[model samples]
Target: MSSVSRTSPTLATLPVDMVKHITDYLDIDSLWNLACTSKVFMEFIQDLKIRTGGYHVDIQKGSYRIELPAEHYCYCNWEEDDDYLIDDLNKDFKDFQSLFPENIDFLRIDPNLVRNFDRFHQECTVLSIGAHPMEYCRFKAETCPTEKLDLLLNNVNFRKGLALNGPKPLVTENKKIFNIDWLLIRNVTWITPEFIRKLKNKIVYLMGTESLTEKDINEYLKDLKSGKIDNRNLQVIGFNTGFGRPRYDREQVLNGLDTTQVLDQTYKVADYDKRIESELFIGTSSANGDIKIFRSFDFNRDDGTKVSVEFMYRTVRVYIWNQDKEQEKEKVTKKRGHAKDTNGPAAKNPYSHHSSPPPNVYNCGVSRYLLPGNIDYLLIDPKIAGKFKNVMDCAILSIVTFRKGLALNGVIPKMWKIWNIDWLQIRNSSIPIPLSMLYNKIINLWDISTITEPQINRYLLDIRDGAIDQPNLSLIQFRKQSGWNSQEILSGLGTVRCQERKIYKLKDFDEKMRMDTFLPFGLDENGIELRDTFDFVRRKDGVKCSVVLLDWVVRVYVWNQMETKKRARGHPEDKDTNDATAKKSCY
Candidate 1:
């Protein structure tokens, strides 16, 4: 018999799983070579689940990198490889595309190197034109990746005669010029209605259109209203008249619609030196209900030094976009099951007077430990507890406990009677809650920030007249940023001293003052410091108190012999031994 010829097994001869595992370890160039070797390998490479890092090549630097996920990269310094061919660069790039036709998401290419971008335009999402200085030049590509390429045009000069009719034709059908969704044209003083009519974009920003007039704007608005062409995709038209003699009455042009004048007067155009003083008019268009108008004026100062050169007059309008209809449609589509609204209240808007409180179940809060139990303290109404869920329970407790107490200078007043509470303890929180919560609940009123004299007088009258049914508040205290409005809260309370005393002198003290005030050490042998103490006899029903006013934390000093003995004996029931906790009261 004869001799037999032997051939090595091809990569495809192995199982697909083994081939996939082997390919995973291969570099970009090796994979590219492998795909080029045979049809079987090409099909295998195309079917491989590869996450492409965009096909980016910096041909100028003779360096390129194929970006991959998870920081795994394959780079080529063409300078190091003497065999690298610059003449066949386009052919090589086409080979990469042919291997993975659906892989390229974005391409950053030098505008000069691209001859007919249309021929090389892969079915991709975004095709960036120019380099860094022109990167802002972006275009939206084909909606479907396999359809065609699209481009985003940014910062491109569109001078009067240069853009529409030039030697190369700035825009052409072979380039698929009409498919752009966003167009940003700068340094253009004039854009004919016909030109604006032909643009198929959802949003357009035209800057430096100093030559544009009110008639042009009116025609544009009218065309938008009539819907002459199928530019329904056209949603927003933004343009600005450059700083010059012509000043359009933007408000007058935008008449016959609901408008709100944003009066802050602080605005500037993007990437320009000029400062803009304009009344931002936000409202729906009278011509087309679906086309909203957010236009502003470019006002000049008396010196004319500060002028607005670049700014879009109009922005996205919600009403014209049928926001309510869309919202209703979304609401219906997302209607899975009945769920309560989590936001505290519902109203027409922030400024609207109509509102209703949130559902009753929404009030559970951050510090549930401090929240008044439904039966124990009755500090908060269970039905409305959900409304105050966001505020610290401790803060509410503090405000409800201390805010209503009698404000006094010499001695603590009969706060228990006024607030219907037996105890008051207060401390400052790391995060302070708003004072309005306390002010509103105690006073039963609103708008605490701008409390007018009349409002204050009226509130005092209501309290004196018993016209307002104040809550049966007890232990009203709050750790606040500012001290309680002492003068306001204590206005009607007459000056009263609960106790007065003169301290007994110690034997060693010449001034007959308390020895404990000057002593750096503990009491001496004679216990002179003990005799220098002053005492106040508590009323039979006096309420226990612990109050912190700003930086000062004040507490009742009870010197009862039996309680001191209990504390010294380590009695578990003596709650006062722990300084951080409050002692429980029978009430």
Candidate 2:
């Protein structure tokens, strides 16, 4: 019996409200010990979303890569006491989920763990199997069979992405992993060219291919070019030849592919998708950012669809560009007096979706708002705002006057990639940007500088009246208009007050925060702590949220909880919901 052994106490018998308050002071190890006492305590711990930070857990064979909490160090080894490996492996997996943090950043699974794969289907930010992270193939370790891998993967909803490591490449004709968010597979020779062509994932990185020839890659590129395969889902895909395998014969891959000319430039994965950004840069600096340097030759289909094919050291990649987006990139380039990647003028369509990103046109190191498919922060001119309603896909799109805003000269023609934006903040735009033109009504609006109280009232009325459908929308917030109060924001919504003194704080907004700076974006997280707040439940989603009023801003936050021990006990003075600010005495 170790320190984490079950304690004999009915912490579960405590009052519902008291349970959270009491457990909030416990350290991770203490919480683990308490959870072992009862299933009820285990669930309470899990629901708290303790964020247990991130664990690089090795179930067996002795390895632990846990991101330590600021206050404590954790050391609990199951492998150290696996006296009965056969019967207890499945029990051990369940115990891990029950005792530790549920939101693991990286969960390592190996041959031993998968034997009872049917029993557990836990979700993690990244799932590494037989983990192949290096450039070279494992060549001689026991690879997980494709079927056994599928058993666990098919049921789990991997939030950020998926990964397959190669002890020696395993085989699969078709598995659910192919259709997940990402497949960064090492010892990737098992994924055939036909398999690659059919992948429905957003980002695919087959680490090292054994049988993937240039001709096979060309065929896959053709599928993308011809629209035979859905190009929209697969925004980016790449594969390197196996270790000491044939170096890419660029000539062979390029042969018979109608090549569109490209330039010597770079693109960061971070510029495109925030999820992929975190996935790639895990355990690394945000600066190097798992950069996938693409120096490609363009290939166009007969119908004018284009794909960029780039070759690296024994690696090749195909970036599929949306047709309308490719055309608009040219127009935007021409407007800027910037040189285009090709000599020909682009097709004229302001409202087309683009595939590639214009190298993050801002000074790097500014923190990103952790939104999915994040188009990097951009300062777009209002003059071009009418052009496709300035349809740029970004987590934060800060609007500024053309003279005030700077657009970096991109070597490759830049276009709007129409992925969903999580936030849009408008600061200096003079003209009225229509709500409809804002695409999906811009999930969480921020600036609303020009927005009138009546307009906001109508927007809220529409949601309550079922005139609008915004399921993805978690919140709508802004700095209060002169003389506006929480009453004005919730006029017809008929909200109720849930708690007054319970001032919970949510700091997920730290570094992971607040984007969408065009009109206004809601930095309102689901895990918002509220004091003197009003609560409302959506009739449609049954989701509850709160409206918090301050001197300057009125925030409509989708009511959720901060991790148990993270609740702050003080007066709330700032809008950021930072726990530290609440504790610091202004006097």
Candidate 3:
């Protein structure tokens, strides 16, 4: 304790900056070990920055820098001399030689191992041949001893050729060799018949617009037949042929294929517009015609390109043929009937005096009703007359009759109770007794259970007389009963007779005589002036039995009278005529 001790500076005792610089070159594992040795050294080593090839490392301002090969560094024990001499040394050497082949570069091995290095160089190329001057300068700047350069250089394998020993035997053909045929053509543009022939043994991927015309298709088929093009082993990836939009037709294309045998292989044809229509045609039409007319030979290839070809027209025109010879005979018969009507009697006036009358009596009866006259005698039963008390009530009643000894054959009498005398006059003067009612009444009156043929004929004659304005009666009701056969009724009417001993035939009547009539009464003075009534004298077997004034009144006259007097008036014109002709007309 009395003597002064001389201090020996240990690594730990070294300046903080110096220790940092020393640990900078150490591997990551070694640096970590060093940091655990002491607090001061721990901080120093922990703060050091170390970077490897192509990698960056960061550190604090006071930390060290380490440049080392990452693959060669065993970072766990950097400070151990045995680890430095064996593990790191061999690892750096192996890593250095791996960067170059032995034949391309030479290694400056130890003099004792020079012979072994020469043999190794003959077989392999050296990765790196000389000392790295840049690495040496870096170490020198950090105050590393120049002798360290020699130690670093020993790890490298220097090539004799790189060292000015005259280029070492060239390493001929270093890359791997492969057969060219093994390579495949992936991108295809145009595939010709010749190209297809050459690829008989190889797999070919086809794409793009390979449009073939009818002629071309035919030629291709001919070639196939003559063995010009080889189609064997041909595997098409994407094959398409069609035309552009609006012009594309698939029917023509398919028709061309049908005629020619070009595609012996199963090639998928798609984006075909014409093909769809062709299939529809085959389904709808029975004609075995070519599909050229319906669709255009338009198609698209695998690459979305258009292909087209023209096809010859082979459509079969279907005509409707009449094989029956009797059709002509029927036509001749129809012509004869038409000619008879066109050139027959009364051709100039088909509706002449011989023409049939209208079916309904209303039109003519209304004409008679509108004639100026006055009501003289109201033919009605007293019991029926008592029913109408109110004017409105009177308008609702109607006069209906059923005549016996006719087709209807039943009891029916004309009876009425009504208001609105004007409406009654209009209706009474228009509608006639229905034939069915007449037939039914006659059967009831004469005690006849069934209508005889003559009775049926009589009812029809009465209906016809009213319909034609030949009789004073009006045929009002004859509405066909539900489900009643018109043809059967016509057939019955064709062979019926009337009570007056007159025969009635359906052929004797025309269409007008079978239809109801609608009369148009005029509203003008000219029409009003035409209004007149006549006296009807009934004579049975040449004896004067009854005389009656056919009283008529124009609607306008009633309306005028109502307007002037503010009340309805009877037919004055008919009354005047009735008074003047009563003595001569009345029996």
Quick one: best TM-score, which candidate? 2
Give the TM-score ranking, best first: 2, 1, 3
Assess every candidate by TM-score. Answer: 0.32, 0.43, 0.14
Candidate 1's residue-wise lDDT over 1-587, tens digit each?
99999886657687886666456534455678788899999888887634443333433223343432212233433543322534345565666667644233333333333332333433332333333211121221212111221232222211110111111112323223344544444444445656666766544555455556666665555444445544544434466443223445554444332234432232311211000100011111121222211333332223222222122222212112323344455567644332221111221221122133223223334114233343221223323333454544223343344322222111222223323322222221123222222322111111122333343334433433445443322112222111123333324422122222211111222221111112211223222112111122223322222221211011112222223333356444343322222322211
lDDT, candidate 3, 1-587, per-residue tens: 59988998777888876555444333344455665677776555434322222111111112211222212221111322432334343454443333211121112222112212222222111222212121121122122122333333233332111110101111111111011111112112333544433433211222122443334434443443344545322211122231111221334334433332222111121111111111111111112221222322333333332333322111111111111223454455655335323112211111112133223311224323333343222222223334444423223124332111112111232433221111111221222433333211101112122323343345443333343222212111221100112222233322211112111111112222211111111112212222122112222211111111110111111111212233245533332222223333322
The lDDT for every candidate, in the order shown, is: 0.33, 0.49, 0.25
Off by over 4 Å in 1: 1-16, 22-30, 33-43, 47-89, 103-190, 207-215, 222-230, 240-587
Q: Candidate 2 — which residues are off by over 4 angstroms?
A: 1-56, 61-102, 112-114, 133-140, 264-294, 301-306, 322-587
Model 2, 402-498: lDDT tens digits are 2111222111112232213444334323345454333322233333345656666666666555566665454455542122444556788776654
TM-score of 2: 0.43
RMSD in Å for candidate 3, one decimal? 54.9
| Superposition TM-score, candidate 3 onto the true structure | 0.14
Per-residue error for 159 in candidate 3, Å, reads 39
